[model samples]
Target: MNELIPKETPSLPSLPETVLPALDRLVSALGIPRTVLASSEEIEYAWRDLPRELREIPAELRGELIARMCVAVSTGLFDGAMNYIWNAAVLHLRNKIRTFGLPVVAQIRQSDFEEKHLLELQDSKLLELCLKLNIVDEDGFFFLDQCRDVRNNFSAAHPTLGKVNDREFTTFLNRCVRYALADSSSPRGVDISSFISAVKGPRFNHNQSGIWVQRLNETHDAQRQMLITMAHGIYCDPNTPEQARLNSIDICNGLTNSFTASIRSELINNHTELVAKGHQDKHAASLQFFERLGLLGLLNESEQHHIFSRAVERLWTVHNGMNNFYNEPAFAERLLEVSLQGAIPETVHEEYVQTVACCRVGNGYGISNAAVKYYDQMIQNFSPREIATLIRSATNNNNPLGRRVLSGGSYRFHFRQVLNLIDPASVPNAVNGSYIQLMR
Candidate 1:
């Protein structure tokens, strides 16, 4: 038979003979299960923090063992040898649980808790740590400032806690009802600001479905007729203030498809002339208006710009050659700059015009004139052949100006001529002497 050797698994270290009994006593008091208690190796790892014995193990091994000890302590398991360290770990985990969801703590109330409630609990991790360590009593409420406050209290007999005893258990539940209603912490609360106003009555006439009408006709309505008054203010028979117009837009943005189409159509019918008038930054404004009108997919970038540009042109014509009315050069330049921030392909003259006018990319040489002088300065230090290759590459990369220069063929001839002067031996094999001749 072939020789067989048994493989041994890594064994936990033995607890020190003198400390073993005391360690066992601590574990018993903490109510930690024997299986969950830190192993002897974990205890040795914790002891590595002692100065004299620190050098006995590799730093990586020390970190690994410490992490294992921490995991045990976080779950309330302590192996007596590292009681202080275990206490600190529990405190840290408690703090962590407050700002983050804790599997153990979250499981305590399954029915009442939600993802958002869990997130709120997670945010109070440090508070949880305080509760775990008994550093702060649950009844203590800490006022952060005028805007906010933190209340930590252990309520054992909360309505949600039915049947669960009012035992002297420590709990820190931050009572932030006002802030919670106002805060937009969760994705579901993206429109929290408006949502809060709606609940507070007449302030936000949120529901479009005659709910406001039904409330107004109530026999025993509130002390004041605010809802009816606000309704009258909104539909003042003829004139709605621009501020109200903007508020309606804000409300439309806040809503999630409830009467959105109706509201948008009403706004358009009332605001068509103003929108078509085209204000400053008409491209951006018009684009938003078109989106509201559900006409966004009907246009492309160039088409949108073209429409705005034409409208501006017409507005200018209507006011005569004054140019002060609309389509001002400065305005067009700003719109063009915004439209062409990154750049697509354009012709040579167009690119140069854009570059010089500060609309497109600028040459690194700081020369502004899109003429032969700048090109000459660019090739001053470089070989003509190298310049030709550089220009050729730029052209191939869709630089319209480069294509224009190369199309002339004179620049290439000049480049080859310059290469001849730099390396005479290579010039003899030249397919064409145009570049070399120009350099010479």
Candidate 2:
């Protein structure tokens, strides 16, 4: 079992008083006019300033004018405002926001290219102003430390994808959006811009816009990682990550029938009765069994997280299913004639039978009587002793996997025999019963 521990916290940074004003000036000087109508003290005093000429204005009118002022600044309406007035107002607001202890500049263009696109200029004059101010650098815009990488650095690039390698899932999202527009013969660029604007509101500054995009990209990258991990876990090994396991559940379910066949071929060889009667309908019966076993909650969670935590539980299910094949009296004597080496553990037959009966074999999609019979015959005909020795060696170990493999192998051997016999009518009833119930 693994133990978790808490990490030590790091020291907090000492915030400087001048940082806010400097950041505010940096952004505002880049052609975005800052309008500071009132100082923090003035605004606080405005509440008491009510009853004066400013108070004579209706509250609704005052609100409208303030909103209008914001819109005008955002849309670059008061372009003729004196440079000194704009700079002074910006400085005041910077100090006001800083006094409250918030980051002055959340985002900023780090490179020349980023700055050019981050804040789309409304006119050539705005671009000229930005250039004159030297706001745009040589590369992209630099954001605050809150930003995280969204791209997949580990995955190899798709051969046909050109330069799309390492990009985050948002890159795919963008592609999908473009595809959808093209398919519908719709106006794309404008519609996409509008959609983005609706999602993140109109971009007040390039810095804010960059931050928003980066945040979204980070989220998509996380989801993509989960998906990739889940797919690998279910198909390759049970010990995979929880997120990956959960993602692979549907794939596992789809492959259940084939897995069921493999289980049957490995478990109840040469049993015609077991074949005829069939094992319980796995999907329905196994689900009900788990519910009765007080394991339904875990089962559901496994369905959600890919059941890696219940490695023991899954082994039990497999064991139980295999034990059903062994109880068949027809197969009991037939084992003597077959090569029993690798087929089943001669020394611990009783324990093997018990363990197999307890394993949880889910919906019949994974175990088949025909397959079990074939394995039984193969073990008898070619390597029964090897199979038996395998069982014995597995049993001697402390690894829970030892028990799991012994149980699964025993079933596989019998399953091979059952299939070889191919006479469903002669199948064993003992092999059809769950060993779990028998033990109980």
Top model by lDDT, which number?
1
Residue range 350-418, candidate 2, lDDT tens digits: 333323322212123344343344334433343333333333433444544244434555544433333
Per-model TM-score on C-alpha atoms: 0.26, 0.17
lDDT of each: 0.34, 0.30
TM-score of predicted model 2? 0.17
lDDT of 1 at 128: 47
| Native-to-model Cα distance after best TM-score fit, residue 110 in candidate 1, in Å | 20
Query: Hey, what RMSD does candidate 2 come out at?
Result: 24.7
Instruction: Give the CA lDDT, 0 to 100, for residue 201 in model 1.
Output: 33
Going through the candidates in the order shown, the clash numbers are: 19, 98
- RMSD score of candidate 1 (Å): 20.3
- Cα lDDT of model 1 by residue, 1-440, tens digit: 98864323223344456564556677789998654444554445433323222232223233444445434333323332132222232333334334333332333333354445544543245444334322333542132121111111211111221111101110110112111211212111012223223433343444632343333232111111222223223432235444453433344333323333443444444334334555334334444544433343344556455544543343224323442323233443433333332222222323323222221111222212223233233233333344344333434526543443345454444434323334444333432344343444
* lDDT of model number 2: 0.30
